[model samples]
Target: MLSIIVAVAENNVIGKDNGLIWKLPRDMKHFKETTTGHYIIMGRKTFESNGRPLPNRTNVIITRDKNYKAEGCVIVHSLEDAIKEAKNDSEAFIIGGGVIYDLSMPLVDRIYLTKIRHTFEGDTLFPELNMDNWNITEKRDFEPDEKNEYPFTILTLDKKK
Candidate 1:
């Protein structure tokens, strides 16, 4: 299964200056839980923002630079090549940065979204999802705590038949 995992605000913002806008630790933990041990495909910028390869998972970085390399991660020239590398995995995750998210949106079979309740001013935004093409398979709301600034909902969407 190909899946897209991201946290989006009410305005569809996902990042600012190549970094995440929110500082929700719970959301981060959820992300780690979902993508751990899966093939994670992301663009170069996203990989850089993460600082290092995620542990216990296959990190596939998609970059146009033929000579680009990141230690402990697989570098691929295109999204297709990244997907091909992940073909044998039971589930591969498309982790973000806007461009990769947009390109993978149509190709993913599932979406694991953390829907933040507030809007944020951000340069990067997630592609608008068409509800007609997806069905919510699961949903759980989280109330804001001392550690988290905003209330959020985790929604799992499956491609509609």
Candidate 2:
């Protein structure tokens, strides 16, 4: 199953200046726990934002740069090739920069979305998805605390059959 793993603000903002705009340790923990063993596909910018490969997961970066190279990552020119690279994984994750998320939206089977209750100014935005075609199979809400900035909800949505 190809799933999208992302965190978006109320205004659909995901990042600004090539980095995330908020701090949410809880959300980060959740992300790590969920995607640890899976193949993670992301855009070149997303991979750069992270600085290095995430341990314990295969990092596949989709980029148009034919000569792009990340020491520990699999660099592919397109999303289709990224998916093909991880064909053996029963569940691979589409981690992202906005463009990658937008491109993968139609092909992913499920989404693990972290919906922050507040809005923010950002240069990148997650593509708006039509809720009618998805079913929320799992959900959990969290309140802001010392480590997490905003109240948010994490939803696991499965594409309706």
Model 1 clash pairs are none
Q: Mind giving the per-residue lDDT tens digits that candidate 1 earns over 1-161?
A: 89999999999999999898789999989999998989999999999999999999999999999999899999999999999999999999999889999999989999999999999999999999999999999999999999998999999999997
* Ten-residue region with minimum lDDT total, candidate 1: 14-23
- Residue 60, candidate 1: alpha-carbon lDDT: 98
lDDT of 2: 0.95
lDDT of 2 by residue, 1-161 (tens): 89999999999999999999999999999999999988999999999999999999999999889999899889999999999999999999999989999989999999999999999999999999999999999999999888787999999999999
Error of 2 at 29 (Å): 0.6
Worst 10 residues of 2 by lDDT: 141-150
